[model samples]
Target: MSALSESRNPGATRSLQVVATAGHVDHGKSALILRLTGMDPDRLAEEKRRGLTIDLGFAWTALPSGQEIGFVDVPGHERFVRNMLAGVGPVRLVLFVVAADEGWKPQSEEHLQIVDVLGAHGAVVALTKRDLVDEPAIQARTLEVRGRLEDTRLAGSAIVACSASTGEGMEQLIGALDHMVGNAPRPDSTGRPRLFVDRVFTIKGAGTVVTGTLTGGPIAVGQEAEVLPPGHRARIRGLQTHKRSLEVAQPVSRVAVNLTGLPTSELERGDVLGLPGQWRGTSVFEAWVRPVRGLDHPLTHRGAYKLYAGSAERDARIRFHGASELRTGERAFARITVSRPVVLDLGDSFVLREAGRQQTVAGGEVLDTDPPARPGPDPAARLRARIGLDRATLACRTVIDRGAIRTPEIAVLAGVTPEEVAAHGAVRLEGWLVAPDVLQGAAGELSAALRAYHSKHPLRPGFEVSEARVLLGQHHRVLSDPGLAEAVLGSLAASGAIVREGAVVRLPEHRASTTGREDADRLVAAVEGGEPTPPTVRELVAAGFGPELIRAVCADGRLVRISQEIVIGPTMLARAEHLVRAHGAPPGLTVSGFREALGTSRKYALPILEFFDASGLTRRQGDVRLLRAR
Candidate 1:
């Protein structure tokens, strides 16, 4: 409930959008923003004295469509990029400034990388200081700037040459912005929001104020919210959107929240405020990472770097997966163990920096914000593979980046239902749901693993069913799911690609029927040619057959081993079974009675009776036993 909506009579809803500025130092970004918004973006005395933007500034204006637009004016210097990201990260549209007098420069390239890495929709290029350069020079600079933007998300954006002093070509810039606001998605009205704290300060009247872009859902006045990372609880004493007091602040709007129960000094620029259970602070997570172009060297495992996410910057240690070293041009799955607690969302885009070099090395999209504990297949293997946004319009992209998701978390992640996710090609497997591509890739990896294992050890019965799950996990993470792996292997078995024999899984062509002509004949003679009872395994070993070979033959299903010292042919066991069924007493089938009835001594009789019980063929009670129900 916005203050207007909660008023005596609410009128038709109106939309307000935000945009940020980015460019090289001295590119006249501040000049352009001031010309359009009628406010000086350089508020700090140091910035005014040095004629350089050392911090972020805010201003706003109305477009021709009567849409109120806010501008987050960011610093153009490379040293202040963390501050620039704090501004641009919360806005979708950008006013990319390039001074015609100086042309493109270094910070321009770095700022543009941040734009692409953060996943902004589109930007409008502003060729500033056109008054200082000639018409041909302006045209030449425009061509150069567009060429630099090639292969980028904003390559196709509209560019207009303008002079803030003369106000030339201002209307064209307004037209481009109007088109963006019309096409930009609307904010979600759901009452769950996470405000990334960018600016925190104190006013005499209001105890403490924190401001950022309100995303995920809506926040109402008097709503209880908690500061994350530290999880300090607070109450929303007041709310302001675009600097006006509002009872409720909607998603995607620039919001300033009056908070109680915490001092302004305790709250910093990187803290997050949200309702309980909607978000949590985490120190470790995983993402699908891609190194940016032109890196001097490879990104190796366990390398520490500076991570810039939303408005927060923290030192992070990277552990590359799929490979120990990530090639510069390749994308790989990696885990990041940060030194600080940060609120992360699935599919959030972030920029990582080599702090010593002051250069951005790689950027990635998060795959799992809340990962399940990966207790490795072998507890000792220590599989260290510990493997945000937005309101309504921002919500859909969040869910897609999240990969495998649960049904209940959909509403909080994307402001939609499970049905909506399924309609978009997500599939349900076991207890979780994942995108179609996840299932496809997992199936392929698991199938390939089975082929590899069979090729290496064809003589083995097959891979143990449990070991198969672990082997697949060692390669691709998504296939380690027990239920899904069971389902996949079971499906493959039904399709004849593999065979399942109790606890073991093997290729369909694998068999346990016989070892060979030599071993089979010897085993048959030993059991059938013997009188009354078969030779024990020790006697067979003494006769020249190795223990392993004899055991393999016994396991070949031609004979049954009742105990370490007892072995019997399957035919003889059937005769003994028939005798027990015909004469073994229901009144009391004692061990002594079975030994005499089967014409075998007590040594073989008790072990055979125990084998029958172990196989569920009979039951033992007190000093007697009886047939078990089938």
Candidate 2:
């Protein structure tokens, strides 16, 4: 099947977004949403009777501009903060509800802090239950809420008054929500999809279905995906966004996927749905964090806490730099060594709460999701952080200078999106980062070596391509990247750096010469004048010829070494070559014919013919020899 048809949905290709509610308990978050959306968020009858949200609830509303916005109504009770955080990461704009009657409560302050640390772009503050208070009281509460929001991302926000019972300012709240949706930035959908599965169940005929906000990328029907942490691969048999079947669901949309190949009993709410092998469990990462204000005890180094990011939660230990006790309201560079790996990206906001009490302690943005250096106060760690802040060009240069870097390593060091890294030519994605020039340089060196080899041994064929690769120490795959390596070799060949001879390579313009040229000439003259059987190396050396001269002539194929004592020049091979050419088989010329032709004795004739047979130039057939075909 085609990749798209097998993996993507044909109908669900639209952008769906998430908006969440933030406020103190009993601040009228659910009621205000009920007034604006006309859908009751608090589904449980007990919750409705108690006049408080005890669990997370989902609601949908259409803005005045006709844009659909989903709301995650989280419990504001301090005890249920975990549930509140579980729904926060996927929200785009926050509906920060503050009661005009109550002003700012503890839960109100904490919820605002959560939104601020989450780096929410925009917010519409719903001043709920305005009818319960007079005008002066409303003004006083607005000022108080404003004061509490100072020095936060949500400091400058639109506050609209509304009453769930009478609907005093529902229209203004809807308009503000519409404005927020219009101005909110869209989430990136280029990376692997990470769906934080908050709910899972089996619907009789639907098999197993899991639902959550799609935080990262698009997911379609028939896609082969995985549930992370446990790493189970499953086919997306179906997908639904806001209860409607879709071909592709975009980022920030609430999606329910019917998955095949996994039993409903094996999946859990905390597990993430992602592309297979796209994310791994990580135990350590560096973060920039600020402590909560007015804490009785300082944040100790190696202090354990509950870490929440995206859909994954883990118990992590915080290791602070230079201070054992982290003071309240203090910002510092800290490392959170998690107990397990969760899908996270650079700049992803995370909240850290005290492990046992589950109280919010600190929160920060993810600077490096897959840091290489160990988390500590060391020079290498500092260097890594500095590199993490560099621009793409500079970062690419740094990695190239270092020789090789993996994709995850580059993502962490550059603090850039992995998609950006993949898109940029800054690094070659051949399982590692290598300087494009280095690969080119190695190829050039190999070609140069080949040309030099050919020039020195002009009569012999060039060296094999395999030998050149060994000298270059580059893999065959590296040589296959288009003109990456080949272009370099071509340049070297053009510049007389190397010579290409069939499958062999050699050096250009190289020749083998001897210091004792005269002595070598005399030996050649005497050998040619006498029988074709050449003299031994000892005899040639004794006859006023040095060993170096003999070795050089032998290396150039001018003299062929049959044994330690036996040697023959190109003249003897020429006769053998001629014999093979004349009679397709050398055995046609018997031992007596070979001896008579070379004017050599029986003793020399047998050894010469036998040497030719052993060297594959000729083959022996019983008592005679046959020439081998070229």
Which sections of candidate 2 miss by over 4 Å? 1-12, 293-297, 320-330, 373-431, 435-630
TM-score of each: 0.64, 0.67
**Which residue pairs collide, candidate 1?**
188-392, 216-390, 216-391
lDDT of 2 at 364: 81
lDDT of each: 0.74, 0.71
Candidate that would win on lDDT: 1
Q: How do the residues 61-117 of candidate 1 rate in per-residue lDDT, one tens digit apiece?
A: 888988888888999998998899788766677889999999889898888887877
Predicted structure 2, TM vs. truth: 0.67
> Candidate 2, which ten residues in sequence have the lowest lDDT sum?
1-10
What does each candidate score in C-alpha RMSD? Answer: 12.8, 11.9
- In model 1, how large is the Cα lDDT of residue 575? 82
